[model samples]
Target: MDLRHLLAHEVAAGIIATGIEGAYDSVSCSTAGNYPSMGVSQWEGGRGDNLLSWIDGGRKFIGRTYSDIVNSGELDELRAALDSEQGRAAQLEILAADCLDYVDALMPYLNDSKCVIYAAMWCPTSTNVVRVFVRNRKSWGYDVNNLSALADVFADEYYKAAAVGAMYRQGYSNRAYNTYNYLVTHEIAWELLDA
Candidate 1:
């Protein structure tokens, strides 16, 4: 039950179905995640500091906390920020940039990335060594057939924060194929089948 092997198998099926060339580079024996991004390797509790920033809108958004909006029924400075034209514009700008990056990551697969990567969860992390899958994404015309199988399998582990899990990757774009999401799905599907 090699997890990476299973991932490559299914992804091969997906690639064949899509008729695309190289959809991925290395199925490294590693995995990573990002909030609203990668899958939880472990059952992380309560979001904590990671979620705290998300609530405060430090990343793509800012302004109010779940409590402030859900319970207090009041908009904070950040929420108020979105209430204006500029704030909405800013958010859109950030989203647009993300989309651009995302598309760049998927450039290898092009139009059919969805069928292979799956639109529901294919999010590619930046072009770096994410946990294990060493992403060499810049190759313009990668024939996935030429790619070799991984020597080991990798997936995110989960438990309470008290438990262990792989550190997630950073920086993302909102382009065509989200490599992160695809990896998560690949990892999960392989784990379940292997289990």
Candidate 2:
């Protein structure tokens, strides 16, 4: 991957790791509706199963349920596996692929790296929502090049959608706002671009 894409992946991964796993090695069987989730981004369901297969040969917990693994003390084993260097690398690799896909999606609407990262961060949880916001903004002739303005539009769109019951969570707007502010405060996008 290019440096910009790599940096975007790293930033998004760190933010997602902080929000979900809090650590690279953390594993949770209950967070995602009792599905075994592992690593930084909580790769769960089919992704979680794929992660397990990649890291642990898929023999331990492929078809097994969460309760079976937990009762068999295999969850601890999974945690230990996730803590390994190979496991962390695998998780990051998968996360980077995911982040890059989001970046690609936003590139058509918002070319600014910061704005793209902000929207890409939401893709993990709300792909359709971010896509709609990007499409709407593009259709309205909004200036997507300005990160702050784009963020404001996103926040406004989020709230308006929530108000009309189009969106389920009011707090989700904060993610876009906070992501934009964080990028600006840290100059993350500029730094990446410079690199």
Candidate 3:
């Protein structure tokens, strides 16, 4: 599966799981004793670090990819000709294509279970950006047939996470225990999953 697809699904799932009356960007808090979190996934690391990580990851990915293109002189000639509007447009087109290609290059390595963990750990915002961008693009009259497939995938992942959350909640109420105690008791569980 494409990384885009996986990311889209996760973002959608997160939106559905956390949405507040159609507000896709709604934020929430988690009371999970062992892993209290904020935002869509109840992500931890303090002060919404999870979301920041995702945004940072996107910036890094784009920067690294663009650097590669620039280093190869792939965009230099096009950039140099950008005095006229037409030339600027051509340069922008090349840049967009190069960026997409960079995204494509990451797809292969992202086709793994670790992608989910990585997102949960580092790139939740990147996926969220995809979701927002696709929706906005469609609203602006752009064809988003390709992203629709990823939206479907998002629905699937949402249900899966909901199920797991349900099951986890059933065994212990986060409200009843202190997060510190829960962390100690569930240390092994966290290690296994986070390992």
Return whichever of 1 and 2 wins on TM-score: 2
Between candidates 1 and 3, the one scoring higher on TM-score is 1
Compare candidates 2 and 3 on lDDT and give the better one.
2
Predicted candidate 2 versus true structure: per-residue lDDT over 1-195, tens digit per residue: 585576557556646544633466676675547667666777778887888777754447766677888888777777778777777778777788777777776777876666777677767655666777787877889987788888877676765643456464445567667777667676344665645
Tell me the deviation in Å of residue 108 in model 3: 3.9
| Highest TM-score model number | 2
Name the 10 consecutive residues with the lowest summed lDDT in model 3.
20-29
Query: By lDDT, who's the top model here?
Result: 2
Question: Candidate 2: minimum summed lDDT over ten consecutive residues — where?
Answer: 161-170
Q: Identify the runs in model 1 with alpha carbons over 4 angstroms from their true place.
A: 1-75, 83-85, 109-111, 115-195
Quantify all predictions' global Cα lDDT against the true fold.
Answer: 0.29, 0.69, 0.33
lDDT of 3 by residue, 47-157 (tens): 334233334221222222333534665443323232234433332333233234333433433333222322222123344443344445446564334333333333333
Least accurate stretch of 10 residues (summed lDDT) in model 1? 35-44
Error of 3 at 99 (Å): 16
lDDT value for model 3: 0.33
Ranking by TM-score: 2, 1, 3
Query: TM-scores across all candidates?
Result: 0.28, 0.76, 0.20
RMSD of 2: 3.5
